[model samples]
Target: MSKRGNRLRNQGKRGSRRAAAARDGNDNGSGKRGARSGERSRIGRFVRRVIVLGVAVVLLAAIFLAFAVGFAARSIPSYYQLQASAVGQTILVRARDGSEIVELGPSFGEWLDYEEIPDTMVDAMVAVEDRRFRSHFGIDFWRTGGAILEGMTGSRERVGGTSTITQQLARNLFLSSNRTFDRKAREAVLAMALEWRFSKEQILELYLNKVYFGGGAYGIDSASRKFFSHPATDLSVAEAAIIAGLVKAPSRYSPTADVQAAVDRAQVVLRLMREQGYITAREANVDVDTVELKQQSGQNSVRYFTDWALPQLDILLPETSAPIEVWTTLDVGMQRAASAAIESNTPANAQGALVSLDRDGAVLALVGGTDYVETNFNRATAAMRQPGSSWKLFVYLAALEAGYTPDDRVVDTPVTIDGWSPRNSSGRNVGETNLRTAFAYSINTVAAQLGNEVGFGTVASMARRFGVSSPISTFPSMVLGSSEVRLIEMTEAFAAVSAGGMAVEPYGILKVETAAGENLYRHEAARETQLVPDYVAAGITDLLQAAVQTGTGRAANIGRPVAGKTGTTSSNKDGWFVGFSSGITTGVWMGRDDAAAVPGLQGGRAPAQAFAAYMRYAVKDRPVEEFDTDLDLPEWRLEPDDEALFGDPDEYYYIDEDGNLIEPGRRDPMDDSFDVEGERPGGREGNRNGSGEPPPAVSEDFLERATGGPVRAPDPPAVPPRQRPRETLDVPPAPSANRQRDGGSGQDQLIY
Candidate 1:
């Protein structure tokens, strides 16, 4: 307008036209912009309305789902009713006299209330299981969302597990153990219901009562008692942590099944507790070292009997909900005595087991080891060890059954069978000895010869008859106890002999009864078939009696008539003594569990000593009954003929310094001066009196001439030294103190 205004009035009309045209263009542009803004506003309104409708539909769907879940929850069974209908009770095992031996429960054990559980146990459970248990209302939404996200992301370490403690309780109580969305939805609903119905403490109580702690223990009360021998209230922090750790996998982490695994899992729980401020690191460390797990009842010496009887329960009472009482054939007094004897007589580095049975095959006493707390291995009935010379009992029995008399002569010299030569433990061969003497001494050579004569197969058959169930090798060494056998079987074998050759099956359970005094089952004593003839058994018993009286098993004699055999394995790895009285039969074995040899240990030592010590108490207050030796047996003549012995010059006679004759094979007394010198009918050159005539009593004149000293003759021999029957004594030595017979190297000596 400024440029056009200069054009003056003449251009006024043209300037006005140009200004109008510019104004029109501006108006058109403004109108188009306003139309576009209005259209955009309408489109925005439509989009907002669609979004509001979608939100309303989603809210309606959510309301419907919540209502559906609530309605479904009403169909769920009541937790209280479920528990009330559950079947869980304890079965008690009693001794023969009605004393409680042990108690076994259902697959799970008794329940405990929340107040009865220790705070440490609850803290451990919360720390290791669900840290938000106290604050969460059945379900943890934050964890659930995170778990869903992690699951969708395929994260390896973050697998979905959004269940809280209440949820787990719901699942365990009402839901099946199937990993499904439907099950999880129900679990969540039930968990919510449970949380609404019970307080936090009540929920924890229900969870503890329903959880499983392995070894057939369920609930905190039973788990605590089973693992710590105490109530849940008495559990220490370490033990509580151990129990809490078993929730994931009970049997895998059971303290009794795998202590190290339990301990490791407990360590993790302790760490979690420390992290959660439930316990301090120092407290956890101390408890870790001090925790003591309960020894399983099966670890007791009574386990040897109980294990044999537990299976009978299923057969007697197939399905029972009430408590049952099992009466066993166990003598508590004898069990204690046997345990004491084994512990006292066994070496510190060695282990010993003993098993005793009555003539009727009732297990009277059993000691699996010196201390069951140290090891749960039931050596009395579970371990197999070489019986050593004790095996000769069967071999000799086979021979006797084969018509060989106790007095039958057998060569005691070394012999070979199948390129296997057996040597006597004595290290010297008694040229010839009767079967009785050979068995008494446990001569390996004679036993081998007898086994060969009767055939190893026959020997094995005899062993089986006597209850030697372990496999027997058909080798010559088998006669010398080369085969392995258990103490229970060995004791049963002797019990069979005590039962007059009847086959005996060792048993402990006598009867089972309900708490109401209703007899569920009673064992009827069965008549056993005769495995060995009365005469054969009697002959073997005679030989074994001789063994206890005068041979290797002499240490086992308890002043009454006893029959037994001593066995010492090679390198002294195992020592055994199996014996029987008229009423009871007992077996004692000593060895290292690892098969390591114990120096100086022998069957005649600790094993025999243990047998004797145990037998003394086992037969207390019982009548001293004698074995039935009714068989007509040949007489045993052990004394050698003097003429036969003196006929050979090579058979040198043992003589003392005083010129007294001693038994040819008997050992000389340590205090006596003895020598083994070749002696002719006449005295030798070095003899003080060379003349083959008894020297006149020493006189003072003769002593002075011979010694060139004024020494009076030594006081006349207290008792004149007896001269040899066929030889004259040249000089009589000074009299010595009274001497007793010394059964020395030829006799079996106590090893340790």
Candidate 2:
């Protein structure tokens, strides 16, 4: 009883203390603190009170976080709302004559919403990238474990990412690309927030549109257009499977990279469709034997065209606003033609490219090389091949400007500049020849000589004035195309020649029209200076044209008038042909990827053949429009000290070897003068001259004779000149076992 009383007393003391504390609380501003029961009171009451307060706060926070995540998830964007659009890049066509090349690709999307993405496309991606997509909320814990385990093992591979579609959506949308724990934590929070805020369908749509599919493609829409040339809305089963397969590794599965790999990946997706019940096991068509799959060729090989088109995009859309598809002027048929011809004609070990453009510098079709897949080195745009004799045009243009007639003789013998001797490809020097034969036969020696007479600086300036971005230093050998030039520059320079020497900047886009049909931009060429005199350019065109009829460029002739030059560098390391017709101009090149010498890949051979094949198909239905005439030069041909049309052709003396009017061995300048017509060896057109002198030109008295009389000199061609076919040498000198032409990176050139 005493013990019980003590307990009671202590309890009473505790109660008193508690009551005092309650009174203190009342005094401090809480109405009153509840007192504990006097003796043996239960602890449940106090514990319960604390529990209730914690629960209430947690419930409120849950409600608030739920609201926040929902709002944030709903705010996900379909596309980056960049304040401005990036400018497009430029590409040149490799067609022979026409610039408006037809190209086929899916039309641009008007406005693609993620929700409209086909379910198949989504599932295909899940099958290859993350099969557990729908089952996970925002993160795949299993995949995360795998990633960690793999990372710890030292391989540190990126193959597995645990983040679910929700997490990816959050990261891609609201986060940055830094791979750090802080970023991962933020990503997780965003994922959870997104899951709470949006429905799976909504999250899925955002994911589909946000994921990058590689190869410069962004959303599914872009991937669809670039790879298959079709929109996601119209995708077929095979195409959908292919796209889904690409999600694993777009670059790896890109048809452009490996068609077989892409096809195999698609098959894997088809098998997944069977397992997922998206298709019946038998109906899934996973059995290669049963299903006939139409392979979608990636042919993103618009390499050369893309290069040309990319630049015009910025000009048309401007960096300020690129909100539309800049429809290019490429001709699908011609582009296909150019690409196919190059691929088929290029030697197995050699790479090649071709481009065709209109007189206005509008690209028609382009192929960078035989295979952009094996190597991304775009031969058409990025590869600088020694232009060989094709570089003579600049030298010839300079000669024309410096008052050197094409008929004037230039020694075709050996020439040395600063200890660097230039030799003809044929190796056998064809003694004294005229400019026509030198150009037609691609005589390197004469070009070097003329380059010296005209001054190498003059040739370099002429090339630059025409907008050939290629660098050409003032070197004597530059006349032989020792300087490097890209196929596009070569073709564009020729286009300038075709356009009456008017400088024209090439473009891919005509206008950037919005979905709403608002014209954002329209592109018209910005003109540079006229590089050559009309008559001079026209005369050069006429001279090179004969190359097709009876010269080294004849392989390019395909029943129509054509003018072009053949270029084969030392050791045949680079071969090129640049030609133009009435409304179009094209450049072609062939070489080995390693820049090694390839057998029989000269510009006049394979490249010219490819051009012919493309043009044969490209110009079938078009009218036969001849090249433009030179209004600058007088209409009728007159010997204004001209060597071919006048008597004794009041010779505009060229400094021959010994600096004498006539070598002691020859009486007349005719013996050494360049033959205006090359076939006769030191003789008149139909008469034999034993004195080793070409017969005098049309007599001035014959000019005074009759208009109907064929007294002496031949009359100049009448109608606006038609491009004559070009011919190639039957047997070009084989590549030497030693030495290659001086070529550098895409833009640089070094010839020593």
Candidate 3:
């Protein structure tokens, strides 16, 4: 203020002198006008200079404040260093069987220290991300100027960036996402502070380990692990470069999420490496397609199974990075077979489940749903649906336990119970038939009647023992297999019988290991004895074998000795087939995601075909022998009928000493001698129980009148028959009926 006052006084004196001079020159009008104009111009120029100085001072203070805030933010701890007390972003670790599956970073992005990363990995990363990184403190001003200059004349994206890894990490970790001048200044300030606080190695390490590489992978370790199923240090040149280039935009360079973009970005990185003299041009320009990533890396399709196995994993292994080896029983062959069987054979509109288990509860192959890629729906253990006639297997077991025999007859007539009248799917009568025929045909009427006779409580108790979670009803409908059951339950129950009647729970995930290869835990199959007499299971098995050979499961017959039963919900809504050849037990289920009906669908059609297809590989090179007929079985024969036991009754006088009509209370007359087939088990020597398809169908249908070539190669057999308890076809299932059914549409097994 004092200086301004002195200047003003001087200016006033000068102006007065000028005024006196102007008065003398009053006669000269031009001179007076010139003096006035000059004084006005000087005053305006002084004010403009004052404004310019004030604006410059304000901008300097703002820049300082921006730098100060960025410096403070740079003090936060990194992802690897953060503790519960640390004021840093969250980092959640996920492990399976004590081995890290993946680690998720906080919204701020993930970070790791230099010591935690491999030097090779760091080198590879630098070579691809920022070849000039070491020469620059945090950012490369010269390169950035070039980038900006190039971008001014070209598209921004096409021009790319020259930010060193450290600067990029600073921008990602401690600054705004904005790109305006103010934001750039803040980013620059943070970059400088990061350089001042951390060594160059430290900065680059954080950049390499914190950046996302898409496919939900965070950090170079995770990105490498996610894309190649290998550790960062193990990365090949191409693989390392591919991950390195992901820093620009993870989604664009993700091998799984965007393969084309990833390849393109990888090429750019290779070119940059050559231009920057990191590698020879010829070395850098290798074909990326020739690179082989770790198998099953980006396609972690086993997520569902891995998730379900986690809870059990905790009890077996409560922590990560242990030294105990846990071997899983998963057979990759079986897993792939199950997946392929479902994907290739299931009707387009339908979703399905496939589970393969050993007699001792070991899960050989398990596919929870049609597409793990589309949805992680674990149909094997999570989904529940009515077992349909498949539930009859348990009913039959209960009947056998209650002293019923294969020859025992049950009525096929409609019956009512608790306001429900259960009828056969076709609503037709097949007259009196033996249990073998009844089960083979999947007769709903007979099954319901038998369920009533066995006592609903007895059937329910048996099913529960076999590992069913849903409640079973005490009604006639229970016989027709109307209770909701999971694929695991059916698989376990059927596996029990195959295992001589012992329950085997399906399980996956052998063990998980740390980055250093330290084993944490392993899985053990849980076995529980669920059946009393092994013979009872074998009896059911004998009948089931016939089903695949000649009954509804004919499609399931791969010209080999296969034992399985087919089940179809009314109207082709659900189809199921559970089969076993000695040790391998596979269960298949097909149903629409929206629960739509498929035309001509039966358990034997697509489900059986799929089972057979998978079985071919699931048991490849394995023994193909069945349980010997003489193993721990009871000495029993087909029971005689009422006509033989009661000497033929003449009226509805209800004579057999029981109130029941179709079922008799008096046991049928026993056959003093065993039936020829049951007595001489060695007769099966002629059966096709070996390792391949039976001699191409010598049946009249498959062969032409002369040439044995299939009379029109059978359409790759669809799964499960078009229906359970299929009607005695007015005509055989041929190509003509097949095309018509596809056009007609329904849950009846149309391929579409």
lDDT rank order: 1, 2, 3
User: Residue-wise lDDT of candidate 1 within 255-316, one digit each (tens)?
Assistant: 87788888888888888888889998797785464677776553456765676567767776
Model 3 agreement with the true structure over 1-752: per-residue lDDT tens digits? 69999999999999999999988778578788999999999999998988898888888987986568566546756545621221222322233223343332333223445675665456657766666777776668887877877778885654246766776777767665776888776676677667677778667666666666665565777776667776676666678678877777776566766677777877777776677666687878788877665454223434555546545655776655233333455665566667888889988778888888876777777777776655677888788777777788888887666555565444455555555676676668777566778788887766665556556777888888777778787655676777778887898888877777766666655665554566565454454555647767777777777678778888776645788888898778899999888588889999975667988778989999999999888767777776533424232222232222222233222312223333333324431112333232334322232422222212334234444334442332233112111112221222211111221233223310
| lDDT leader | 1
Error of 1 at 724 (Å): 44
Candidate 2 global CA lDDT score: 0.67
Off by over 4 Å in 3: 1-208, 211-216, 220-311, 321-326, 509-530, 626-752
RMSD of each: 22.4, 18.6, 21.5
TM per candidate comes to 0.64, 0.59, 0.51
- Alpha-carbon runs more than 4 Å astray in model 2: 1-158, 171-189, 199-248, 254-294, 297-311, 318-327, 336-345, 369-378, 473-475, 558-561, 616-752
| TM-score-sorted candidate list, best first | 1, 2, 3
Which window of ten consecutive residues has the lowest lDDT sum in model 3? 731-740
The weakest ten consecutive residues by lDDT in model 2 span 734-743
Best by TM-score: 1
Clash totals, every prediction:
1, 41, 34
